[model samples]
Structures are given as C-alpha cells and as structure tokens.
Target: MYGHGYTQPVKPPPPAGLLVLLRVLFLGIAVFSIGFMAWAPLLRLAIVTRKSLDWGLFVAAMAADVLSIVLLGSEPGEDVRTAGGYLGITLLLGTLAVGSVYYLAADIRHFHQLRYPAYPVGQPRAAAYGYPQAPTPVPAPYTAPNPRQTPPPMPRTPAPQPPANTPPPRPPQRPAPARIDQVRAELDELSDYLRKHDEGGR
Candidate 1:
C-alpha cells in the first residue's frame, strides 16, 4: 500500500573463469612489481585501492594548465622561434592547450565516477564478486468505486413527507449531516471487498 520495503538490487555472480583470470592478472602484476623498484600498489591492491579512491586527477589537470601557461610566458628557444615566424611555437602551444583541456575533462569525469559509479567497470562489488550489470516505482490510485459493488444509497426524504398539509410543508428542512460511524463502517467494508476482488482478479 505504501511501498514494498526498498532494497538495493545486486549484480549476479561472475563465472569461474573470471576468478581465475583475475588471479593470474594479480600474480603477473606482483611479479612485475618485484622486478621493478618494488612499487607497493603493483604488488598489492591494498596499496593501490584506498578506502576512498584518489586518482589525483584534479591536481594533474591543474598542473597541466599551469605548465602550459608557464611555457608560453617564458622566452622561446631560438630554433622554435625561427621556424616559419613562430609556426612551430604555435603548434607547440596548441598541443599543450589541447592536453590541458583533456586533463580537465578527465578530472571532471573522474569526479562523477567517484560519486555515482552505479555500474562500474567489470561490475564488481568491494568484496570482488565479479559480475556484469545494470526501477519501476508504480502504484495505482483509486478513481471510482469498484464496478462490481452497488453504490451507496443517496439521501431520501426523512418520513415520506408524512402529514404534509398539517405541518404546512415544514419549511423544507435542511438535509441531515451524514453519520461518521456509519460512513466509516461502509468505507471499511468497501475496502475489504475491493481488496479481495482485486486479489482474485490478479
């Protein structure tokens, strides 16, 4: 009636092959890390993956932008300045500007991925339950009374206009207010009947 108690949908379990593939990948990375200068992240996911992932993307973006600006402001090298009246310099600046834009876009995308990675790559949970992924909040409202039930009766004249002439038509008395207890009972009965009917129809 209100809401079926809400639950977060979970992804399905991955195949056995996926687990083996991951294990092999980690083993390779560990061997490579040992061959290299003992990078902790490569050796163990615990070092790479934090309680909160920080890719330093924003800092990288800012550094790219600032470095581009600095290069432009500095004195140009003799070789670059002489190439077709600074055409080479122009291309250099353009490349830096484009790279800066790329970094900025990447940082923004990373921010969104951090906040709302609803279906992340490989679709694995923190527990490493590898799985592939991907709401209908629909409740109907009552419009009219159920067609199967008889409608409640309308108000009628109190006593069939008894002794009309003697009472001089009684000044056309006001309609009586509906009785709460009676209306409530009728509603309860109607609800129960309609519920049962709906269940049967289903």
Candidate 2:
C-alpha cells in the first residue's frame, strides 16, 4: 500500500557487489589503456595487429586512449620535457578517469534497460521477487428495482394514552410544626407538681 501508485513492477537491481566490481574493472581497463597509449609505439602496434586480441575490447581501449590524448592536446605547451609533458599526462589521466566514471554509469543504465524494458500499456506487469499481483476487481452491473412488486412497509407502533378518569399528579406535602401553647401548658403542670411536693416536705 505504501507504494501502490508504483503500478509498474519494480525491476530488481543488479547486485551491489557485481556493480561495484564492474566499475572497478572499467576503471582498471581505462588506466591500462592510458598507460598503453602513453607510449606511442605500442599503441601503433596494437592498431596494426588488432586481430591479435579481442577486436571489440582492443578497439574500445584504443578509442578511449586516443580520445584522452585528443582532450590533452588542447592545452598550449612548448615541449614534452617541459610544461607540455606534465599538462598532457595530467589531462590524459584526468580524461581517462572521468571517462571511466561515465562508462560505469552508462553500463549500469544499459544493464537496467536490458533487464527491464518498458511495460506495455494497460497490461499489468508480472509479479516477481515476492511481490503479489492483485487483480483489478470488476464492479457489479446496476439494475433498477421492480415497479410492480415492491416490499411491504414496516408496521408502525402507536404511543399509549392515559385514561380520562386518572387524577393529575399532586405536589409533595410538608410536615406540621409543633404547637407552642401545648408545650407551655406541659411545662407549667410540671412546675406546679414540683412546688406542691416541696411545700408538703417543709
């Protein structure tokens, strides 16, 4: 789901170690070519007897060497022993190194192209390397409901009504207060009894 938008099947990349090895190999080849070219006689011999080695490899190496020389030749100098030699050697080496880097990048791109060509439009890419290919689901076709045969409506429940003779609910009543006059009469009776008892004793 994270990369759902990437409908194109992910192309497995070349092994990292393999790629790194290839880059190093190319650089080594480029260096060997530069060294071979530095001495003009050997380069001439190689060109003359190209059939002695793998024709493709020899030609590519030669081309790389010549191109580096050409790039170096652009710099102004007097003689090979002076600034000319230094500049030429420096430029030639730099050109070869840069070319090697470029070649490495190009070779990687070429490998990718060979491995993964453009996927055809509309056709989903085949799932490989543990990736699951989910099929696009088709939706069901729509149909109108039958006009003559409709489902019966649900029954409705009526609310309950109170009886007409039922009395209305009354408010709660408060407790009655104690009578002050009754309390005073009790206190006076108690005092009179006590007073008569005390007088009889004396």
Which one is best on TM-score? 2
lDDT of 2: 0.59
lDDT of each: 0.46, 0.59
Best by lDDT: 2
- Residue 147, candidate 1: alpha-carbon lDDT: 83
Which pairs of residues collide in candidate 1?
A: none
Report the lDDT of model 2 for residue 142: 86
After superposing candidate 2 on the true structure, give the runs of residues whose Cα lies further than 4 Å from its correct spot: 1-19, 31-81, 119-202
lDDT of 1 by residue, 1-202 (tens): 5654667874443455664465455445434533121122222322323322233432343354345445445546534344343543353344334433443344345444554567543444444235443322345676887889998899887666566458554576654566767788899999999999999999
Distance from true location, Cα of 150 in model 2, Å:
50
Model 1's number of clashes is 0
